[model samples]
Each structure stands twice: as C-alpha cells, then as structure tokens.
Target: MLKIKHFFLVIFVLIFINCSKDEPVDSQETKPLVSAIDIGNSELPYIKIKTISSVLNEPKIAGEMEIYINQKRVLNSTIGIEYRGSTSYRISDKKSFGIETRDASGKGKDVSILGFPAEEDWILTGDVFQAPNTIFDRTLMYHYLGYELFRNMGNYSSRSKFVEVELNGVYIGIYVLMEKLKRGPDRINIESLIAADTDAAKITGGYILKIDKTSGSDVLGTHPLSYYDTNWDDDCRYTEFNSFRSNYDINRNRIAFPAYGAPYHSNKYLETYFVYDYPKAETINAAQKAYIKNYVNDFETALLTDNFSTNTRTYTNYIDRKSFIDFFIINELAGNIDGYRLSTYMHKARGGKLKMGPIWDLNIGYGTGGRVPVNDWIINYNNYVTNDAWMVPFWWKRLMEDPQFRSELKSRWTELRTNTLSTPKVLELTTNTSNYLTNNNAIIRNYTKWTGINYNYNNSVTELKTYLTNRLAWMDSKIASF
Candidate 1:
C-alpha cells in the first residue's frame, strides 16, 4: 500500500511540472506595444487631415501611444513591434495640424515628436476679409465691366463664368474661370489679324491654354485691360490693326492686315497671336511694312478657294468693297482717331475678302483728352487728307483720293447716332448692376483690392457711369457710320 501511494504522488508531481512548463513566462513585465500615432484637431476651411504613423530605430521592450485632438481619439496603434522606430502619415488640409500624443506603456521610452504633413504647414488665421469698394469698382469697371461692354459691342471675347462661395465660413464671391483655348502653329496668311506681322521663322511653337472660364484669363493673359494707361503715349496699343485685317486664323497660325495707321499709343501693347515658328524681330518687320504682300496674295487665293464658309465668304470681291466702305465710315466719324489700331478686320484666304472684327477701346473719344470731338463735322474735311496719308499706299494715295469716302462717312454717322443713342437704357443697366454690387460687397471688395483699387463706392459708381456713357456714345457713332 505504501509503494502504490508513493507512485501516485510522483505522477501528480510530473503532471504539475508539465503544466508549469506549458504556461508562458511573464515576458519581463512587457509594456504594451504602440503601433501608430494619431492626431485629431478642429476642421479647417479648404483643408483635410488624413493619417499619422511613427518611425522606430532602437528595440523596445514595449511601447504604446494614444493621439488626440481637442481631447478626441485620433489613433491608437502598436508602438514597439509594429513600427520599430519611426513612421509618417499624410494629412489633407489647407492648414497645419496641432496634435498631442501620450505614452501609455510608461516603459521609460522617449516619445517621438510629431511633424506636420507635407504641403500643409501653414496655419490659416481666418482674418482675410473682402477688399474695399473703391478697389472693386475699379476692377469691375476695368476688367468685368469692360468685358461686358466689349461683348455688347459685337466683339469676340472669351465666355465668362462667375460664382460665389464660402471659404472658411466667410462668404466670397466674384470668383471667375474661363475655358481653355487651343492655339495652332502660327502661319502667314491674309486671314490672321493678330500676329500676321510675325515672320514665319519666328512662328515656331504653339500652346494649349487651360483658361479660366470666369476670369477671362485666356483673353488677357497676365495683364488686364486696366493695365493700359488712359494716355495714348503711356498706353500699350495694338498697332497691327491698321495693317492686319484679320485678328486670328482659326485654322492656321498667322495674322494679316491691309495698311499701317498712325502711332496713337505705345507699340508694346498686348496683341493675340497663334503659336508659330518665327523670330520676334521678323514678325515686327512684317508688321511695319508691306513685307508679306506675296504671302498675303497666296493666303488670299487659298481663302477664296477654301471650302470653309466664313473664309470663302470673306474672300469674295463684294465683301472687300463692303469692308472698305465700313473702314472709311469709322475713320471719318472718330475724326480718324486711330480706327485701324482700335479694331480688327478679318479676311478669308481663298477669296481674299474682308469682314468687320470687334471694336475695342474707345474711352478717349469725343475730344475728351483735348482732341477733336465726335460731332465736329469740321474734322470730316480732313478725312481725305488723312486717308491719303495713312490708309492709301504711297502709290495709290493720289489716285484713290475720292470725295465719296467722306459722304459715306457722314451718312453712316447720321443713321447710327439716331438709332442707338439711348442714354436712359444704358443708365438702367448700370443701376441694376450697381444693385448687384451692393449685395455682393464682400466679393467685390476682395476683387477690387486684388486689382489695387481704392475702396470708395460712390466715387467708383460715378466714374463708371461717366465712362460708360462716353463709350456708348462712341459706339453709336461708329455703328451709324457703318
């Protein structure tokens, strides 16, 4: 009986030993592992926050980190095993992040410092406000207002899109973007009006601009129309108008015109052109004289024979006579105030015909700048002499000196002024626009400041009204002459 009891005790002891071996050791009182670090904070306008992680170099017994923003749980990740040393996370926000982390394991481990995500380092102060009224008035009048007038005047301008939105809880308006324009390689043709003067050698490359639909960025490039000074000498004027009849060649890269007019403004003005392979010097040379006559003739022949409808029609002989008559009338009405420089004329390459382009920049008319007024018939008498000197080529000057040009001008002026001179209608439009400005003062002010205009509502309105009336009158006179 004693032996049997001893055996049973031995068996029990062995079982106990096996059980003890199977159990895991205390792992040296291991600290909890930290896998990731998270950061949470207040939401920002135009910004988004994503994820955060850590980088670990030295081996740790145990690690754990808890991230929070405004006391909110951002992330809880294993520290020691998952990420041995350090890691990074991406954040999406207009502003930088403010985060805090806690070491829960308490294993005497040094906590890693958190860094902001790339491209989100700045903190928005939320202090930006709308610009003043004066600034907006100027910007609206010069850019937006002028654009509207141009459209009304039958000009080909980029379509505009305007909108208002809230940024950071602040209402902002007058945001604009335009459509992209595809510019082809520049080529010399009678159809092009803008860069016709550029030499074929200089017209080398082309570009496709993803233009902003609302802002008219494509039409103005970097410089706004307001950048031009009111003074003729200080203003950058388009001198090619007198010489190039066409503004742009939709199909090819080229600009062409008929004659060179007087230098009314600075030559360093903005002129639209297609991408072309040519040197700037050569282009300028082509613009100054009849250097591309043969090219023009060839372009005209192509236009006349081409299947394109606009080009075919413009190149016809009848259109040429009509264009000549139109030009003569506009010249006489404005006292020959550089019509060729202000407007564009387009011609088709195949038929060598002509058509009227958009009318631009007539704010200084009616002798406003100590020049001759529009109604002064006395200015009409000099039409023949001016035409002979400017419009007619040196050889054709004496031979084409006909009095019929003057008569045509006078007759057109009478018809246009009588039909279009509706000052009250224009004022009504201005009043409605002014109301819109009032409602969206914040956006208007912001844009005004961006354009560098002083904030003064009344003054801006008065100035705009005056300019509008003057410009409208000028347009009426031109149309009548047509």
Candidate 2:
C-alpha cells in the first residue's frame, strides 16, 4: 500500500511540472518582432521603435529601444526619451519625445541614424496640439519652412527631416527627427568649457543663456519695470528693455547650461538670470559662477546704458550682430509668440561675443500661435498686448530704433526673401513637405487618430500658401521702408 501511494504522488508532481511548461515567457527578455512593411519610394523616412518598458511612465522615461528605418534594422541600444514641449505634451496619445541616443550601457553614444547631419539627440515631434491644423498651420510644414528659411539663408539652424515614428509597435504620426540644441562638433560650434577649470578665463568663454519660464533653479534677472511702470513713456516709452513687472514679479532669462544656482547674496536678484547648464549644478564651483555673473552684468550694463547703440562701448561689443538680425527675421516673418521667450537659446563661446541663434522652436509661429496672424508685426505687439508674459527683447526693439541696425535688418531681409524665403521658394518648400506627408499611409492614420475624418488637408495647405504670400509681401514692404 505504501509503494502504491508513493507512485501516485510521483505521477501527480510530474503532471504539475508539465502544465507549467506551456506558460508564456516574460516578453521583456525576448526580442520583439516588428511588423514588416514595404512602401516604395517614400517621402520621409519611416522609423519604428520597440521600447522595453511595458510600463510607459508620464513625461516619458528611457528604456531599451530599437530603431527600424524602412523595415531595415538600424540601431538596438539603450536611450533616454521623454515627452517634450509645453502645451503639446498634454496630448494623451499623440505625444512628442526628446530622444537621447546612447550605447548599450547608456553612457557614451554613437548616433547618426537618418543622415540628418549626424547628431546623437533628436526630437520626435508629433505636432498635434493644433489638431487638424486649420489654415495650413497644423500640417507642420509652416514650422519646417521657417527653420529652413533660417538655415538656407546661411545662418545656423537645426536641420530637420520628417519621419513616421512607430513607438512600441503602435503607429504614431509624422515626427520631425530634429537635432537638439547642444554645444557640439557640428552644432553651436563653441569652445568646450569645463568645470574642473574654475579659472574665470576658461569658464567665461562658453555659456548658453535662455529667456523662458522661470524655474527656482534658474539664474534670473528682474525686469526693470513694465511699459506701464510709474515712469511711463507714453510716446517715446520704448527706452527701457529690462524692467520689473507688475502682474508677474519677474521676467526670467535663464542660464541653460553649466546649470548652477547663484550663491546667496544681499542683491541676489541682480544675478539670477544666468543659470549654469553644461557642467551642471553638481560640478560647477563658485569662481565659475562669479565669472559668468560679472560677464552678464557687463552685457546688461551695456544694454541699459543711455547710448546703447552709439556708445564707444556699445551693445554690438557684446553680441554677434548677424545672429541677432537673422533670428529677428525668422521670428518676425513667422510671428512667433514664443519668440525670444520660451525655448529661445543664446550661447557665448570662450572669448566669443554673445550670439543670437541657430533658431529653436517655432511650432506655433507662422500665424499658428492663434494670438496673431502671420501678417501681424511682432516688433511692436499691436501696441495693445504689451503685457504679454514674454515680451520682445528691448535690444531688438531698441536696435530697430537705430538707423544702422534698421538698415542691416532691411538688407538681411531682402537677401533672405530673394533667395530661401522668396514667395516661390516658400511655396515650393510647403508643397514638397506637404506632398511627402500626404503620400504616407501614416498621414491618414495620424490624422484619424488625432482629428478624425472631417479634417481638411487641402484647405490647410491653401491657407499656408496664403499666409506665406501675404507674410512675404507685408514684410517686404515694411522692411524696405525701415
């Protein structure tokens, strides 16, 4: 009886073990299969990614990801990616990401996935906030054209290419595979500044500054006073560039790199606008902070002086004038509400003048911001919306007040319009980009997912053409007089 009972127990254990063998294995450990696709002669490159994270967190986090270009495997590596943008990030499904390419260990990188001028970091922009892009602004060609105008005009602008990105096997819409603004061999092209060398000589040479949303960690400066400040200049009231605000206490221009906070001082507000970004907060020392602070103080001092334009020591001494003029044309033509405000970047090279561009974000520009049209002039914001959260630099407005600056601006504008920004060229860019997007099956999928069937593609393109035509003409007429 004991032998029989032992035999039954052994059989029961064998049965249990056999049952567990058929269970599905963990998906993470295994390589994922991508759906094979063959679309001949595509407009933009088709990109697909498979992320290892089953749990995708908010404000996207990095995971092991694979990249497929036109169904051919290109890269399999670890990367850091996060949903990026201000209002655009709110989209639940159609989200954009900031991609950081790295080696398998997530340190050190080897990038250049899509021949887009070879940069490690790229942006997968969904561009979905202005859903269905009414009046040509939503198709995203407007923003593309704006950047290309800047680049094609011989100024440094981020090179962008359109891509249909598939994330985790799901088709996300058209994304612009764009270079992230960083100090690099091909980008910004500034001398490398290091934290180990705390000497002011090395530290003051290269720094990137931005004027944007105030962060507690940011280096900031207070506005001198609003246009409506007590000593108001009702008629010739344009003299002040930096001012203290009434409704919002501060208009912050932050130090984006070598991101260190200022030391506590009696008048700390005097030097909060230049936050450290590159060496980062952890590595930066006190001497580096003081060096940047004094450098900025000198620049601001020159800006605020009575003879900013004509003084023997002038504003031109502090900046690269061409960069400023080029940047102004892009913003003014596009009517960027966020111009000189958010995502705006400036860098000072080791012993180099403070430079204006390599123009950044313009998704809401080209009359897309909804606050103003592409035809609207931003040099003076309709003389009504002066209290905007982000105001144009007094430097740009003040420089316009100078005859020399105005002449330079008009000359530059003419040169751009005649070449890259000409009506015909602008139309061609929009049409080509639009055609490429329309040719992709993902275009329909993206729009259906984001805006449904009623969305009008033709009308949007037509509206864009109209905006560009009107914008070019208006700017030409006005700029010539300047």
Candidate 3:
C-alpha cells in the first residue's frame, strides 16, 4: 500500500509540471521580432498613417492617422497627406508631408494635435531624410532654433513639435510636426481678404506676399491666372494675375532684365518678384491686385528715393520699422542662407503698416555657408554669390545704411544678447532638445531606419552648439559697430 501511494504522488507531480508548460512564465525573456528592432515603441509621440489606397505619391492622398504618446492613444483622425517642399522633395526618399485633417465627409476638420491650437493644415518636416547633403541639418535643430528665437522676439513663427512617424505600418523616422503658415486667428493673425472685398476701404489693407520660386500650383499646372503682361515687362515667368516685379534692381537702380522668361538670364538675379500668397493667384481679384501692387510700389519708391537727411522719413509711413528691425536681427542671428531671398514672407493688416514677419524655412541655416564671409551680414549675399537665381532684396541692405535703422538694430541686438539669445541660453535650448531625443532612443531609431547618410547624431549636436556660440559672438562684435 505504501509503494502504491508513492507512485501516485510522482504521477501527480508529473501532471502539474505538464500543465505549467503551456502557460506563460513571468520571468521568461521574450525576443522581439526583427522589425521591432528598428520600429519599437519609445517615449516620443508616434504618428501612424494608413492610406486608403496605400499610396502617397501625389500632392493629396486620403488617409487615416493615429497618434500615440507613451503608448496611449491621443488622436485618431482622417487626413489628406501630400508630399511637400520643392528641393526637399527632389532630394530625399523620406519626403516632408502636408497634412490636412478631415472629417468623415472629406472636408477639413479643425482639431488640436499635440496641444497646439486647432487648425486643419499642418506639416511634418523630416530631418535631412536620406539625402547625401552632408552639410544639411542633420542636427535637426536649426528649424526649431530659428523659429523659437523669432518667437521669443515677439514675432509669430510657426509652432513645432518633434514626433516619430510611420506610414503604412513602416516607420519613416522622426519628423517635426509644425503648423503651416496661414491666415488665422491663432496663426498670422491678419485680417482676411476675400474675393468680394473690392472697395477702397476693404481693398487697401490686407495682403500676404512671398518671394519664392513658382511651385505648388505651378507644379500642379492648375492656376487659372493669365500670363503676365509680357509686351512691356518681358519676365514672362510672372503672371499679372499672381505677381509683380520690383521697380528697382538689387543695386537700387531702375528695373531691367537682361533677358526674359523662365530659365532666366544670369542678370535676372538682380530682379525680384512679389508673389501673391494669401488670396492666392486664382482668387485675388483685379481691384485687390492693383491695390497691393501699388502699395508695395509706393513703399519701394519712398525707400529708394529717401534722402535720410531729416527725421521725417516718408518710408516710415509705409512700413513698421520695429518689425523690420526684429526680422533683420532674427535672420542675421541664424545666418540664414536663404534669409531675404527664398522663403521670404511679408504681410500687411487692415489699417496697419506693412510688416515683415512670421519667418519661414530655416532648414539650411545656422552657420551654413552661402559664399559669404562667416561673420558678414546675410543681406550681403549678392556681394559673394554674384549669379545665383535668387538674390537678397535691396530692403535690408538699404535699411542697414540708415542711421536710425542701424541704431534701432543695435539696441535690439543688445537687449537680446543679455538674456533670450545669450550664448549659454541658446546652448541650453540645444542641449535640452538633444537630451530629449537621446533619452528616448529616437536618434538611434531614426538613423537605423533611414540609413546611408552616415549621420553622427552626437557630433552633430556638439557642432551645432559650437556654431551657435561662434555665431552669437561674431554677431555681437558686428552689431556693436552699428
């Protein structure tokens, strides 16, 4: 009887061990899948986009996006995503995207994402992408730095947040989710100009103009505007319905293009065109167009013909001097290679002076060379790169020539260096941003998936800090002379 009981106890132990084999063990280590190595969960916000047709090649593609922050679902919304940027699009496999959040009926829906004010249009700008442009912003902090500095100066720069992105279940890498520059109460904060506002009081005021290459609608080939008056002004690339040319050359002389049309002559760099940005090329009416064109023309005329012999300056009547001063300081601070030429924006408000602000596109900035002296003013770009397609406008160069303007600029620069833009402060911002990315393992994950660029994340951050240090010092010495 004792032998039979012992045998039964052994059989019961065997049955218990067999049952435990099929159940999960809390102590056992589980290896992650192969894809999880590159695209695993992390501390940064994760934006996953699933397209309806699994394609995002065109300018606009229907999709649904879900954002997760620390593994918790924050937003799920329908969206229209599109490849954005002209040069950035052509240069990288990981393209920037313009996202418009939508409702079920496919109309733009306003919803707050990442705690920013509710707005439909947003942009996801990636860092360097897969381009071999080694000098490009691999540090991924230039845009944020430039915009933040401008905002600190009491200007309205685009608000941005860093986030990781995945499209169609494939991790694309880190992107700066930013607000698009547009006319809104929370954005540029300018009065709107619609098609019917053709009267004297309504038409005399608001307009947003940019000096940029013909893109977006030009690439889409859908602008309803007519060709510019080519009979007199032979720059046929411009259309009377959309743009107007500067009355003076870069040297502040009468306007004259050496040759006309697209693929313009080398001398075309001397000429500038103000493209209609707000009302758009298609919707801006004849009366409204004439009003803004004349206003800008008047401002230029007063600036160019000014004697500067007295305090009663006529140009001051047209422009807000403080805005121009701040804009100049911000661009000079960043060493923006494209500062006054490409991606430049100027706007006017109802019954207000023409203002230069809401600075855009600082990707290729922060000590990037543009054939100019490292310590020189970016507005003097033409003094170096003589034959570039886009040249710095005469506005800044002329403004610097004015004693009052120089005094104002010097005062502003001095105030900024004391606190907001001091070397230690700027370095702190850069270091903090880098630490956030590093602590979350985002830099490693981003570079792992978007390889071949050979980006040195740590070194890039170090170099950025060094550049800012030197740049701020140089600017300090130069602005002192002003």
Candidate 4:
C-alpha cells in the first residue's frame, strides 16, 4: 500500500510540472528583421508599433498599439490603421496608411509625434512602389519637398518628417510621418462650426471642402462613396448627405455633363463637387450646409459674371487672391498633375474669404504625368485630359483672366523663383534630403525592402533635379509674359 501511494504522488508531481511549462513561444520579437537591411544603426528616428491584433485590414478596426521611438516606448494606446490612397493602395505592395490614435476607452487621444503639435490623426506615407516600368516619383521626396515649398511660401501645409517604421516586429521601410489635414490651432487654424451654430455669422464661415473622389477614409458614421458612383449627372449627382455639385460647369456655363458620370465618359470633366470635410456629413446641420452651398454658388456666379458688367461683383469679393496665387505657384512648380482637382483642400474662416489649401497628398507630382507638357499650368488639365472624371475648377481659369490676378501671379512667381522656388534652392533641398538619407543608410534600407522603387538613387535624384531645373526655367520664361 505504501509503494502504490508513492507512485500516485510521483504521477501528480509530473502532471503539475508538465502543465506549468511555458507554452511554446511563437513571438518573433527577438529576430524580427525580415528584410536584409539592418536597422540597428539607422540615424533616422525608429518607430516600432506592436499591434494586439495580428492584422490591420481596415480603418474601422481599432488595434491596440504600443509605439516606440528609437526603441523607447512613447504611446501604448489603441490605433485604427488601414491602407490609404486609391491608386497607390491598389498598385503597390508597400502601402501607405491612415492612422487615428485612440485611448484605452476608444476615443481619440491627442499625442505629439516627432515634435509636431498633439493630434489624433496622422499618416505614414510609404516609399513609391510601382509595377516593372512606370512613371513613379522615385525620389520619395515629392510630398516632403512640395509641402516644404508650400510652407516656405507662407502657408500652413502638412508638417512631415522621415522615419523608419517597424510593423509588429518586421522593419517595413522609411516612411514620411505627416500630420493629416484637420482643423486645429496648429493645423488649418479655422473657427469651429457645430450643428448648434446655425446663426448667420457662425454658419456663414468655417468649412473645409475637398474636390476629390469619394473613395478614401470616410467621414465618421457615413458610408464611403465608391469610385464607381455616377459622380456627374444632370441633377448634379451630389446628395445633401455628403457633398454638393457646382452650379456652374467647367466652362462657367450652367451645370451640364452631356456624357454624365463615371465609367470613363468623355464629358465627365464638365462637373465638379465639393465634399464637406470639417463638420462632416454626419454632423453638419442643414443651415450650415445650405449656407456653404449658397456661398460657393455666389462665388461662382460672381466669378462667371465678372466680364459681363462693371456693376457685377468681382471674383476678388469672394476669395483671398494671395492664397490662390501661392497655391498656384506651388502646384505649378511641383508639376502636380492632381492639383486643383483631386486632393485639393479649401477652407473658409469666420467672416473671412475662401482660401485654398493646407495642401494634401502630393505623392504623384514632379513631372510624373504625361497628359500635360511640363511648360503649361496644371490648371489646364481639362485642355489635356479631356475625359478625366475629375477636372480643375473653372475658378482657376477664371481667376487667371483677371489682369490683377495675372499681375499678382506673375509677381509672386518671380519673387518666389528668386528665393523659395529657385532652381538652386529647390535642388539644394532635394540634394540635402538625398544626402541625409543616403549618408544615414536609410535609402539603402528603404530600397532593400521596396525593391520596386527606383534602386538607382543617384540617377533618381539627378532626374528630379533636372526636371525641377527645366520646369523652373520654363515657368520663369512664361510667367514673364504675364
């Protein structure tokens, strides 16, 4: 009986020992370098994000993320991340992302990143990725350069910085950590308009609108409009829910698109729609919506009727012409094919004239598009791509017709060319950025992961410099005539 009792005790001890053993560890934290590039010695700030969920598929899923800068943990909070961009997302394996920082309770938490102002919204723009042979902005500086140029021109463009990123445990590549365009004191710096502010002065101003496809991250509590939606129609196609179609066509004529809507129609360029961004589709009240819509209509009417009579309200009565001039100069210099149309942002402050920008999404710029020649204004997009669904607003072309507008544009261009947008200054910015990345081994690290990127870094930089030099020369010669 004693021997049998001893055997039972031995069995119990063995069972306890087996059960207590740590479950076979599957965490890859120790050896997470999936790419050949060794990021241990990188000079750029290292951002490591470990998500609680194994995957980030869409904007709605809030994954718990622990953020570390240079291996020191700074934020351990919930983050909603998803692939951003329409063409970039579909074509590239290395995808950019839209991020929203949230707290433990799932509300937006303001956190300052890379010394920028505390904001819940941020973006991680991936290095350019393309198919075998295509016109890719390989320098990866188009966005940074464009934003810097705009900011230097005395505007509040999105502030961005280069940083190395690690997802889960794998080093992805170098990404541009940028502030998302939102209304804040440090950002757009516009007055807030809520549903309750339906009074005359409060409702007349403080609105952000986008002339973009309804495809990216949707306004909160609203369904995203598919790119396939019929964007242009006789009824103007814009519903009161999210956006409003322009009362005038691209030619300053009455609203009309004979080919009507998307699916590649020839006359789709005739229409334009302004998507409400600030108060958003879910929050903006009817009075606020009506006021903005009417305001835009009034601007268009005033602009279209300028040449009709001296008594007609001038276009200057509706807009800040300086903002327009600066906006035009930056877009023209960057050779931004999508300028004035897609990704364009315009806002109005309380009792202030409508203004253009805090420019956003400039990745596809710097002579990438073959649709228009390098010498022409991008606002002439309609004249080039006759069938594009999104067209430049009649505002730009109409504004250019004004002698004062042309004189101001010419003066601004000449002034900026001598300093801010000068060929040497622009090239210096490009070269310095290039040298910094290469000297710090970031270019090698990024190119190693994103093999689709232009691996010949020097050639890409030379190409960018050449493009800018030629573009600046052309603008200098052409703007002199104005």
Residue 394, candidate 3: how far off, in angstroms?
0.9
lDDT (Cα atoms) of all candidates against the true structure: 0.31, 0.60, 0.77, 0.75
After superposing candidate 1 on the true structure, give the runs of residues whose Cα lies further than 4 Å from its correct spot: 1-139, 142-157, 161-292, 295-339, 342-352, 359-421, 451-454, 468-482
Model 3 TM-score is 0.86
> For model 3, which pairs clash?
none
Provide the global lDDT of candidate 4 against the true structure.
0.75
Q: Candidate 1 on 379-438: residue-level lDDT in tens?
A: 333343332211222111221233343345446445444533246654565666666555
- Where is model 4 more than 4 Å wrong at Cα? 1-37, 54-57, 64-77, 131-135, 219-238, 256-267, 308-313, 452-454
Question: Following a full C-alpha superposition, what root-mean-square deviation does model 3 have from the true structure?
Answer: 12.1
Task: Write down the lDDT that model 3 would get.
Answer: 0.77
Model 2 Cα shift for residue 250 (angstroms): 9.7
Worst window of 10 by summed lDDT in candidate 2: 235-244
- Count of backbone collisions within predicted model 2: 24
Model 4 TM-score, all chains together: 0.85
lDDT per residue for candidate 3 within 6-113, as digits (tens), equals 999999978644432211212233222222234455777778787867444354678877776765666777788877665665566777888988776668888788
- The reply for model 3, stretches above 4 Å from the true place, is 1-41, 54-58, 130-135, 217-236, 257-260, 452-455
Which model, 2 or 3, shows the larger lDDT? 3
By lDDT, the candidates rank as 3, 4, 2, 1
Clashes of 1: 87
